[model samples]
Structures are given as structure tokens and as C-alpha cells.
Target: MANKNVIWCDEKTLQKDISGKIYVVTGANSGVGLETSKQLIKQGGHVIMACRRVDAGEEEAKAFGDLKGSYEVMKVDFADLQSVRNFAAKFKAKYDRLDGLMCNAGALFSGDQAQYTKDGIEMSIGVSYFGHFLLTELLLEQLKKSAPARVGILSSVGHAGNAKNRYKVHFEDINWKNRKYNGVDAYCEAKVAVNLYAMELGERLKGTGVSTASVHPGWARSNFGGSGVMMKVLRVFLYPFRNSITNSNEESAQTSLHVLLSEDAPQHSGAYFSQHSVLYRDKECRKGGWPMTSPNPHAKDMEAAHQLVKLSRQMVAL
Candidate 1:
């Protein structure tokens, strides 16, 4: 199901000039994050590349060539809450406004044992969901000050796993403290949290010029998911048809670009977007597939979304 009903987006989908606009992209030193930042810069937009490794980010930024827009690298480790807060404070102090914030950094753990972040929270949920939560919470005011700003969250089709029951959040044992550690399930649940957060955040921000949405970029080949045995098996399985089955980094970035730059995206603010052609923006800039409902019923649970926000605030000490 993850492979079906998806659209393949290209450069033609987004041709608008965004000169002078300011955006912050997490994990921007590589993969989809790098591609997204490159395109935004090509369109004359200013980008703040937030990365765990500042040196790596600087190295990549140097290779961007002479582009219409510009970029600067900042450091933030999603595994550490203090780092996220520090980045937020520095950003607000340096920039007058923020037009967009892309919560694009993510990680997957396929090892047998559970891993933890610097804060002791489960690694997958900690880095992929909680850090971004704290960053967005801290930047809400700046986004409001710069009305018409947007938050684009990068989700995954794995959120709606290939399992028969789909995926559900384990609120009672969110940190994997009580259950057998399963890395894939942990990743899926973390993604579900982000999607739910986008839903609830949209509801709370109504009438505020800032809007939010979550997107699923079709499975793209990258150095993500690590080199655990499970991942190796998956790679070997997909290697035969990886080209036909997976999207390239540039192609995977289309959905994110469309959601952030499309003029029609505001109306669909609480929705989930997938990589299917049906959800793409057309030549006239009208909505194609978005406002697309998430396949997971649990992701649509408004009550759960609210509870998640509450728990997240407590976890991040917000």
C-alpha cells in the first residue's frame, strides 16, 4: 500500500520566486533536507541549515555554489533538549522573522536493544518527534510575528505500516520502558505522533497566520535507517527493484516543496499529504491530492492528539 497511489513531483510543480523569505530546515546537511534547502535557495529564499554537526553543514553549504538565495549553518542536536532550546534562542535573536520551519531531521533504529537520547527518552521518539516539538513550541511567537508562516513536518508512509492493524501510539509506555523494544514500531509510532501533532496544532492555530501540515515522501534511497541486520535484509529485498520502487532524494523533496510554497496549501492546514500524483498541485496552482486524510484512524483521533501535546509539553518541560 505504501507504493501505490503516489505522485512523482518535479521542478515544474514549484516555480514561484520566494526571494527574501526566511526558512529553517533541520538535518539540512544531507538527503531530503539538503535537496529542499538547495531548491529554496535556488528560488532566492534564505535558509538556516540546522544540523547536529555544524562542520558538516558548513562543508555542504560551501558546495551550494552561487545561488539566488543564501544559507547559514547552526547547531542543534535533536537528542538533547537543551541544544534545541539554545538553537531557538539564537535564531530568534538573529533573525527578524521566520517564514517557514521544516522539521525534517529523523532517524530509525533497527537494533535488537533499545537506545536512548541524552535526555533518556527512547531514541526514535526523542529525536524524530520531541525535539522538533520543543523547537516549534519555542518558535511559535516568531512564526506568529511573521504572519503567513508555515511549518512543514516530514512524515513517512511507514507511519501507516504494512501490518494488518496499522499503527497506534503507546501512551502508557511511550518510552519503551515497559514493552519489548521493537525499533520499527518505535519509528512508526514516532511518525504517528508528528502527524497527530500537525492535526491538533492546526486546530489550535486557527485564525493565526501560521499553519501546519505533515507529508509522506515516498520511500527514497538514502543512508537513513542505518546498517542493522534488519535494515540489511530490507535493503537486499528492495535492491532488486529499488530504482523503480523508491524515489530519488530530489523527487522525494517535491511534496515538501509543494506544501511549503503552494499558495493553495493554507486551506488544507491540518491534513496529511502523501507522495501520490493525485495530491500534487496542478498548473493553475490548485490543490490536487492534499487535504488527503491519513490512512491510520489513530492519527485522526483528536483526543489523542491533544493528550500527545500535553505529554510532549511535560516531557520537554515546556
Candidate 2:
């Protein structure tokens, strides 16, 4: 369930001394990313909005009113593993430290047929899970140096009570060759992976002061999900309902920002937050048993996320 007061903060709410602190937000050209970046800029923080669209990204940067805070746009195509590595390397070489990383970009219920990323993985799997996983791994050092850094993975509430996901933990065929592809299912599974990755990364980054947590942004009425006819029709009928059912992007984004900036949750690693507070991680995840309902419940299966990392390494040839 979503908290009634999930959105406790607004653009004028917190004055984070981000003037010197550097942060990177992906999919920053629109929706929640844009709002989050705007809020940060309003507080005098330096933000790098990474988006696949250069023109849109620059337009977003220009909207900050003043480029004085070092607001800039960076290129990042999440579906491309090489692009993910390029993004991290580019960031590391230019900045001394990074204070926060909000994995704002996501692949939502796209109705498009199952497609592989440049790396040959399913589109949703590549963009939503593998891409962010690599970015976080490559940027781990700077995040640690900025001690007590926050790594927030934007998850979804739809992850609960869902099993029509077309495919199981087909760890063997992550690309989904044998099973039919369901865009919503893929998105849900990817979100589940996002939570698992957070837990896995928490263990690997222990003692580094880099906190990790999964956050549900609440159903955001944003421009995502583009699969095909069936999806298109569903979206049309769901539009009116969606508007009322989901919170605005900015409103939904508050939960993610809270996890990243809240002093109260400094030690909230490996936890999942819905709205502004931690919620139950499904009975299975809590009991050390695989959430049969979740596509991938084993948080320790970081090996899958790592495979993307390996592909990134090979792409960057690092």
C-alpha cells in the first residue's frame, strides 16, 4: 500500500547543499527525472542529467534557469551496455566525487515485442536491470569516497501479487527466446531484479558507507510503455483510470528522493521503501525463501546483473 503522505517534500521543501555535491540521474529528460533534477537545481546543486535524447536532455538542462550550478547533459542509452560503461567512465574522469545516484530511468510496461538490447538481452532486462547495475558498480569508488552516499533504485508496487510474467527466472535464457514476452511482466520482473540487485550490492559494498535501497515511485503517469496494438488499446482505456490511479511523476518521485536524502534512513540498506517508508518485502523475500510470485526473488543472484557488468567491461574493454 502507498502512504498517503508519501510525498512529504517538494521542490521548495529541502535545501540540500548540492552546490558542490555532484549527482547523476538517468532518463532525466522527462517525468520524474526532470522534476527531481529541477528540485535539486532549485537548491543550488550540481546535477548531470543523462538521457538518450541529446536535444531533450539539453532542453532539460536549460530549464534550470541558470547553468551556474554546472547543470549539464550527458548521453546514456540504457539498452546499450557499452553506453552504460561509457557513461560511468565519462563521469569518473570528469568529477572528483558523486554524492548521490538515483536510478531514475526505467522501462515501463512497453507493449513492444520482446527485443534484445545491443548486448542481446531482452529490452526491459537490459535497460532496467543490467544497465543500472553496471553504472553503480563502475561508480562505486567515488560513491564511497563521498562517504555515506546513497544509491536508490526506483522499483514498482506492481511487483507484488504478479505472476503472469510470461517467463520464470529463465536465468538460462535471460533474452527470452522460449517464452512469449509480456511487456508488463518484463517490467515487473525487471523491478523485482532491481530490488534484488540493491540487496546484492549492499553486501558487496559493505563497509564502504554506500547505502542501497529499493524504492517504489508509486504508479507514475509518465511517458513510457510502447509495445504494440494490444498494449496501445489498454493504455487508451487505462488513461482516464491511470490518471486517477497513479500519482503524478513528481509526486511519485518523492519516495525515491526521500530514500536518498533522508537522514532517518542512513542505515536502511537492503530494504524496500514504498512512498517514504519501508514496506514488507513480500512474505517470501523476508522468509529467506524465493518469492514464488516474483520472477527473481533471490537477491544473491547478482551473477545475472554481473553478467551485464562483464559485458560492459568487455564493451569498454576495461
- Which model scores highest in lDDT? 1
Candidate 1 Cα misplacement greater than 4 A, ranges: 1-13, 227-240, 277-289
* Colliding residue pairs in candidate 1: 6-276, 6-277, 7-275, 7-276, 7-277, 279-289
- Tens digits of lDDT, candidate 1, 1-318: 234434544445467788989999999988889888999998999999999999989988888899999999999999999999999999989998999999999988875688999999899989989999999999999899988989989787777654366677789999898889988889989999989999999899999989899987766666687777777898999887665567677777777887788876778887887764322223221122565766678888999999999999999998
Against the reference, the lDDT scores of all candidates come to 0.83, 0.69
Mark the 10 consecutive residues where model 1 has the least summed lDDT. Answer: 279-288
lDDT value, candidate 1, whole model = 0.83
Question: For candidate 2, what is the TM-score?
Answer: 0.80
Can you write out model 2's per-residue Cα lDDT over 117-197, one digit (the tens) per residue? 887778776787778878887888899999878888777665553333222244555666876777777776777677777
